[model samples]
Target chain A: MAHAHESNTKRIWIVFGILSVVTIVEVILGIIKPESLMASVLGMKILNWIFIILTIVKAYYIAWSFMHLEGERGSFKWSIVLPLLILIPYLAFILLVEGNYIYDVYSESFVSWDF
Target chain B: MEATVNTQTEEENVWGGGNQPLGASYGKMMMWFFIVSDALTFSGFLVAYGFSRYKFIDSWPIADEVFTHFPFLHGVEAPMYYVALMTFILIFSSVTMVLAVDAGHQMKQKKVAWYMLFTIIGGLVFVGSQAWEWATFIRGDYGAVELRSGRILQFVDAQTGKRIALDEFAQPIEDERVVHLERNGVWYQSGEGLPSYTVNEIKAGFMANENVVGRAEKLNEDGEKIMLSREETAERLESAVHVVEGANLVRNEYGNRLFADFFFFITGFHGFHVFSGVVINVIIFFNVILGTYDRRKNYEMVEKVGLYWHFVDLVWVFVFTFFYLV
Candidate 1:
């Protein structure tokens, strides 16, 4: 915490390079959208899985480097990251499952939504 | 003496009154708390967006087809390029902000000012780009028809698999219907502005053009919009209730109305944050130019603002992925 006088120019540029390279990779993959990756692995496409994972990776780097979470103490870091770690996935799971169920109901109903 | 001894004993305990928790300053800890809560708010919105998308998974709009326009390349089919550029601008601005914080740590006022200026410019550019994106989305390149069942039907060239604009095919009608304004239409209820072309004109145009076909909002197994045959296109045209030109609260030329709704609300909220962030950065930039932080013997103010700017960039990373890419 006391290394206030040290120059962090090198570290900042390195992180910037990493972020830019990752973004470029994401854009390329999005544009190309290879057929193999488009196939479903589990409930979703492998390509979509790749995008979500890469986005998480980018988020990690941005939070750790740009927001200086790396310099913070263990307890401080956990306090911020832990609650979201638990809540976001749980919320996503519930909402998605419920949404799919609703779609099932709508599709099976007698009324034809379209003419 | 007794009171002083008791106070000293209390100060030695683990829950001491004056100690900072987790070795963080009061302001820093509060900022972290705010960030955590804000992150949850964003997640809630995103999760809702995901829920709605999943509910209408079959009929959702493909982001690539919808956001294909670039700034200067008219009629070009460059997909995801402009958004990618915008993402880069934002990330680079985050880098500049972190660098500004680093410079402040070294007490390098000149470097901090320069880096802050760069960050401000980047933020302004990003905000401007978002405005342009919203404008493009509102003034749709091609128009579509809204069916009676509240679904949109777009036109496409069956041969080239490209979208066709309403203006290109729809024949103008010589009807005497005038635009009803607030004062002339009714005493209290104002009539909405009528679209340029009526449904009859579009149906006639579709019938006349042999190459044009109507595509439904639903996606097939290949994640592409399902295009109806010429026979089906003619049948579907009978159900056209309104000619939808662009996005509004009720109807959107792009498949799902909810998509436009979420796009507006979530991005609008995020844009508001970026706008406020720019205004804050400008004030801080002026302060740096005036040597206020220097006179205070510490540049923690820059670091604090840098945290906020980085958080904004962080939110955008997720927004870019969920809204544009995934």
Candidate 2:
């Protein structure tokens, strides 16, 4: 209860400012869609990579600041975040790779009977 | 006798009711667990969306073109602006929610109530904006023709390089079109409502308009829809079988049908979360005004709901990036 009374309104507002700025930057980039960023880096467009990275930044702030995960004990924080970090990317990777493989098959081998 | 005393103390200190293994209250820990599971659920849906997008990588709908409408700015080609504003509203609401939790920590009843009220208002506004967005999507802008192969072909004026809606240039024709009821048709057969224009009518209208050209769903290297030449468009027009005006489970004017399905499912699910969060916030807001936490000597209830509100906002950031930005 003693620690509960401590005020961190200033910090909350700062995080909010960061989130708003990040969102605005994302929107501006989406609108402009610079040609340089349109080029593919590994497989995805550089612009898409930028958007995903910014989104992760925003998610980190929302979890750590607004949700107060930073105040939680280290073990508990990891218990929550670690599962998501490990599982989500694994799921995304498997699904996306399979989908791309299917796309290749469709383009290279699967011939439509309509022709 | 000394050993007995030590055993009693150890019993009290053991990993039972008195333990705070995670340094979190029971309810808060449970809330975090629920949030973790819920996050995985959302990720499953998003990952599925990614799979479908990759499967149709070259012909996937351009999100900017699909979600171009803005409220009160009719027929204007403002892209990403409305969704961006919605994102701002949602994030602002999240700020107010966290502020309420902070004020609750300080035991400021009035401040907590004010912030909660702001958060609830923001939630309602976000839900309303999402509804409008869904409506705009279901009731499409530029109508398209569906080829026999389930590909969409949108129209653009060749000179101006802008989309032209079906009603704008599609000529009127009278026909004896009737909805097929189960009794009138085959024993188990029924039909959905007919589109405004038939395929022959569209073909006739397209033939009459010399400047209008068909834009295929496939994107070229530059990531723009491949615009067919006039002769190619005319040749492609011969295969057109149906007019697709808006989105539904069966079809959409958007390039990929799966895109509309994922859009409806994911956003609808997220909107449902925001709706429930508002309801929870209202309950807690009332409890705050009633001074329930004041008597309880803690505002942990508010903190729990704050966690939830922030979680919703967190999910939206991903949705915005994947659905709209990327």
Index of the highest-lDDT prediction: 2
TM-scores across all candidates? 0.94, 0.94
Q: What 10-residue stretch in candidate 2 chain B is worst by lDDT?
A: B2-11
Over B191-276, each residue of candidate 1 has an lDDT whose tens digit, in order, gives 66688899999988988899999999889989999889999988888889999987877789998889999999899889988999
lDDT of 2 at A48: 92
Q: Quote the lDDT for A67 in model 2.
A: 95
B1-326: candidate 2 lDDT, tens digit per residue: 74466457657877656556667889999999999999999999999999998988988999999999999999898999999999999999999999998898888999999999999999999999999999999999889998888888899999988898988778878754866766775777546678888888788888899998999988999889988888988888899988999899888998788989999999999999999999999999999999999999888999999999999999999999999999
**Residue pairs that clash (backbone atoms under 3 angstroms), model 1:** none
lDDT of 2 by residue, A16-54 (tens): 999999999999999999988988898999999999999
Largest DockQ belongs to which candidate?
Answer: 1
Docking class of 1: high
Docking class of 2: medium
